[model samples]
Target: MRSSDFCIAGGGIIGLTLALELHRRGAEVTVVERDIPLKQASQAAAGMLAVRDPDNPPELLPLSELSIDLYPAFLDRIERLSGQRVPFQTTVTYQSVGHSSLRPAINLPTGLIPGDDGLSRLEEHSLDPRQLAPALLTAVRNTSVVILDHTTIESAPPAGCLISTLGPWGAPPAAPRKGQMLAVSVPASFGLDYVVRTEHIYIVPRLQGPRAGQAVIGATVEDAGFSTHTEPASLARLRGLAAAFLPAVADETDFPIVDHWAGLRPYTPDNLPMLGEIEAADPGSTKRFVATGHYRNGILLAPATAHVMAELLTGEVPSVDLCRFAPGRFGKA
Candidate 1:
């Protein structure tokens, strides 16, 4: 039998980050994952750190902003400990409007500037999730956190002070929404330095390595449960959307379709994460905390969620208000 003062189920970013925090506070920590750690939603994410996203509801803006503010420190710590380049690049988001439509004068939010492409340019940031996962995994491995890969944890309250970061597979049932995306190579003069988003799609440019000039075109949100299949039709639609935003990308058919992939986002009914303690079936049982249902913001919110959960586990009040994310908020999760 495995034992630890803190056993975290699901070693995605949230689980790993929380485990690191708890271990730093002198707790024995073990993380159990169904597959390789950081290979799930954490790795598949596009890593857009958009706090003041045009679409974010006002109620959740503070948490999102807090998480974005916390990212710099989080990335620095991981880089210091793991010695891996966790790429975080500050960029702009060009929210595109349809051609021929009269451009409405938008009261641009803070950090947003008017753009030339019939779009609003919002100063934002992004990182490569592919790089982040490994850096986090490496950092945790350097610590006292025990990671059990390829191990499925089945028992309820799996261990003492259990924290479930099992996205889409935990209580309250976060449904898996699949998204299809594709990456294409870019020419030297691609003239694209920022992310571009329409209501239906987003094009995020890559910053480093061989794919440096390339950009990722995504995604189609479908209510396909846990299915990671890359649909050609969805990819084509994404490509079409990318073309609508950047006409140059469509003109170059020979750049080569670099990669195509899909990932399942954990979407809750309320679209808020479940945090805090689980109400034990038997009142006398030990406490089990949950931290999941982040949907598309998992990458953006990991630091704050880990910090909050770590604070709660250590018998301290979280700096951030979490009343909206209480585990039992959605009918006894």
Candidate 2:
């Protein structure tokens, strides 16, 4: 019967980040997770800080830029608290322009990211999730915030208010879209310094640790409804997508898939995050709130989400407009 001021429903990156912020504001917090924290989308992400990705909704741009802006300080805090270096990967992404809908970065004029071999170079920020996730987990553990792993919020001492940061369980009460990804080792001579992304695939080279020569390729978005199953056909298709950019990955004998995984992304009907308080479950009980349904942008939006959610929780006006992301949006119109 542990108790706290706020009990977070999920302990993924979003959850932990919010917890850190809330705690900073002097709120005693508790986090309840069904499984390990960061085991979901946070761990499965490609860690691309795709702030200017043209595919993102227009309403998301401000928040995206805000998050990317805060990334440096956020990473610093994580490193300071956890005492671990979350290795950085690259500061640029090479987006394939051929047969792709990608507009110039920041809607710049034509030839912004110069295209070569049908590929365009865009300045993007990316980090190694393998390093970030663990460091985040360690950072949280070092904090006074209570974490109840392998448990649900219901088990925590009843709190009048609850916020859900459960990444894929759909805090906005939406569906979970599954994504599958894989990584393969590349040779040093390959000199894959920056991120290489096609229409639907991205190849990121690791430059640190034992994974130095490995390139991470991802992912497949599926409305599979919480299914954890990874399909060979899906992986093969991703490999083919990667092959279009780096022919060497196509040869399993040469690259050899070192690791493969599947994760769920929270998907809302509007494809926007729901970041406001949930209407009271009962006339005067259960003041619920949701900070989920980030879909493909959870990793990218974490800092912004945490900042805005903290502002909302602390009764301060969120610095960014959240009307487009209200939890009850679907019920409107």
- Runs of candidate 2 with Cα error greater than 4 angstroms are 98-118, 171-173
Can you give the lDDT of residue 85 in candidate 2? Answer: 82
| Global Cα RMSD, each model | 3.9, 3.8
Instruction: Look at candidate 2 and tell me the lDDT of residue 332.
Output: 27
Model 1, span 1-333: residue lDDT tens: 557888898999889988988887899898989888887788777778878666655667877878888888888889888998777654777676545364633654333333444675677898778878888999999987789887776642246788889897666567788888888886756556678776688878788744587778888888887789997778877887677656666654644588988988888877778878888888776678899999888998898888888999888989888888887777776
Compared with the true structure, the alpha-carbon lDDT of candidate 1 equals 0.79
Q: Largest lDDT belongs to which candidate?
A: 2
Runs with alpha carbons beyond 4 Å of true place in candidate 1:
97-118, 155-158, 252-254
Candidate 2, residues 1-333, lDDT tens digits: the string is 756888898888899999888887888888898988888788888888887765678899989989988888889999899999876788888676675564544432221233343555678988877788889888888889988889976677676568987765644357898889988987666567788776588887788866788888889988788787888899999998887667667888878888889988888877888898877646778777889888888888999999999999888999899998887777721
Candidate 1: worst-modelled 10 consecutive residues by lDDT: 108-117
